[model samples]
Target: MNRALFQKIIFAWFEKHGRVLPWRVKNHEDAQRMSGVRETLATYFTKAWRRDPYRVIVSELMLQQTQVDRVLPKFEHFIKRWPTVLDLSRAKLSEVMIEWQGLGYNRRARFLHEMAKRVVEKYNGVFPQTETELRTLPGIGEYTARAVLAFAYGQDIGVIDTNIKRIFARVELGVEANAIPISPKEFQSFIDFSVPKHHGDPWNQALMDFGALVCTAKSPKCDHCPAKTLCIAQRIAEEYRVKTYAEFLKTPHRNQQKKQSIPFEQTNRYFRGRIVDKLRESPIHMEELRMHMETNHGLSSRKKFGEIIESLVLDKLIYIRGSRASLD
Candidate 1:
């Protein structure tokens, strides 16, 4: 593959069509024009916008397994509420959980709170710059660590999230569906090779935008894709004019197969959310909580409900005082 040509095409497309996100910093001319402030792009960009590690960390954590549209308002609200690591570290975890109501995976909010506390106490409230230091924080993994380094610090490191991985699998490896797993080592090498040396941040962000908008997993816009000519999977799909790689690969029988039934209310996640939601309002006695769940949500087993409460207490998500339960 001609790497230079590939980079040129992708970057050109991104310049014209990249999404105008709130977290993204505006160009120098635009920033100055809007704010009536005479500052260099680098100064405004680093000190005021995208280079703020706290904003990047909050945005990244909220975005895990969540969509961009859903994250935008929440991210703005969160940052407005806690503008710095020191502010977040000083806030109560229960208040944090209350703010994190709509965004599920409540555990993430707890981890984020813990991460803030640690950063304040251990690192003097400044977010870490290196991948190793970042990974030491709560709930940060390999992908998230690299993302922080690249996006916030402008490090020339590769970031391969699910979307980028899918793009590489289809465009480079000729894989039809992103569901087909690629070796981690192979994927890392592709990211390393594809990421440009100088424009590492924009390069990674462009690939991410391209994957989300054009090269989506369910229904790819193959005809409109910039890399369609060079994409092996797209070339193969053209024979059938396939819109979705998964649909193209599905057998008729499998397509018609019935999905298994799982009751939402009965699941642990649902009950846990309910418990948190109720506690968000006010503290309730243990017996009163069980009765409310049984009456409203058809929760029949007291033993099962007790187990769930115990788990929540163990997770430090809630506290039990005498006979009452409330968010910690």
Candidate 2:
């Protein structure tokens, strides 16, 4: 696709049907009554929350493989607790982990903690601005580093995540709606060239929202979709598949007959049980903690349990007073 044509299609789609999110303040009615939607989106895209690298990094990290709804509360609480990289650096590692309890993938909490320390110690409590510098930090990868630079620093570097990947795969690769391909660096280049001038941040975010709500992983509502005319997947569905959208809508999801979800057991889960077990036992020395693990408990090894205890200690769930360990 040509750059100007791509921009016209995407921007047209975004202007007419872009989902309004709470974070998008430019569209707020109080801001301006007569602003064009495209201009409002562009203003929101450029001027919105591009100052703090830590905020950008934290939000991105919290969002990793997690849905926006699940991440919102956790992200808010984290920012409230830490406020800044400096605050997070001064905080106990245990405190950070405790705050991170419900987020799952506990390793991210550890990485954030270490990243905070590194920032404070090495970077004078300020997050690195460039993508290269940010990438050198613990837990910061290419995607995350680029996200920080683009979202926080207002850099024009291209960012392509899962949502953008799905859109690009369908549009460029002529893939089926259900069979989106993985994103390649070539796709990044395509986006860099095709992205609306001076609208990289909001444009990327809009693409994400578009994929999530309209061009969904399952059962996309192509008729309502902004990119319907230009979409390869929709064209394929029309040409190759005999079923109309109305008829397709009548079909139940393939796994609809399966259980809606796996049972979420609070008590039987390993960590919850371990916390209970630790509380029941009398205060034990670190050495005694190791011995108990080896003798009575069928735990993998004392070393492993010790590491858990250490994490628990850092998280402030457990603490050692003198040589004995107990719940905090």
What lDDT would each prediction earn against the true structure?
Answer: 0.74, 0.64
Compared with the true structure, what per-residue lDDT tens digits does model 1 show for residues 1-328? 5678888988878777777664554332343354544333233324423356777778788899788989988986887688778899999999999999888899999999999999999999888888889999998998888888878777776788877888887786556333333345435654666778766677788888888888887777775777877876655555556653444545342232212223566665678778888999999998989998889877888877886686577557899999999986
> Which regions of candidate 1 deviate over 4 angstroms?
26-50, 177-182, 238-328
Cα lDDT of model 2 by residue, 1-328, tens digit: 3446655766676765676542343222322453354334545544554646777778778788677888777876787677678889999989989998778888888899999999999999878888789888999999998877776666776687877777776665455334433224334554565557566666677777777777665666666765666655456446646343323434453133122322333111343245447666767776776666556555555455654565456446677899887775
Where is model 2 more than 4 Å wrong at Cα? 2-49, 176-183, 241-328
Q: What TM-scores do the predictions have?
A: 0.66, 0.63
Best by lDDT: 1
Q: After superposition, how far is residue 295 of candidate 1 from its true place, in Å?
A: 75
TM-score of 1: 0.66
